[model samples]
Target: MAPNKDNLFGSKKEASLVKSNQLDSTVKEILASEQMNRERKTARLRELRLEKEALQPPPEPKAKAKRKTTKAQE
Candidate 1:
């Protein structure tokens, strides 16, 4: 039996034929997935901000105090 030429040089023609279609599909899928991730992240940040606002405590008013005066001896 003779040695196969496809194995020696790594079959450039066959590789190109299969990968041409695959590259476009993979790129489209990745862009769509990244868009979804960005939307999800934005939603999550908004939810967290709302939750933090709800959890905060309200400010309290300050009280006034009276001072005492000392008398002088003659």
Candidate 2:
């Protein structure tokens, strides 16, 4: 039987390719997890903010200050 060179201890190029694929998969999973966590936190914060705002009375509108008219010098 011929020795299987393609298994575990394959050529450098093959090993590198395998490692690259594994790294890519790992990085993709990490990014997805972070994104999901960020979204969940944002939603929770938004809900809390909405609840707080609803409980608070609406703010009264402030009156704009009238600007003093400058007299033209002759």
Clash totals for all candidate models: 0, 0
Q: Candidate 2, TM-score vs. the true structure? A: 0.84
What does candidate 1's lDDT look like per residue over 14-63, in tens digits?
88977987998999999999999999999999999999988988657767
**What are the lDDT scores of the predictions, listed in order?**
0.88, 0.94
Alpha carbon deviation, residue 10, candidate 1 (Å): 18
RMSD of each: 9.3, 2.2
TM-score of each: 0.45, 0.84
For candidate 2, give the lDDT of residue 66: 100
Looking at model 1, the pairs that clash are none
Q: Candidate 2 regions off by >4 Å?
A: 1-8
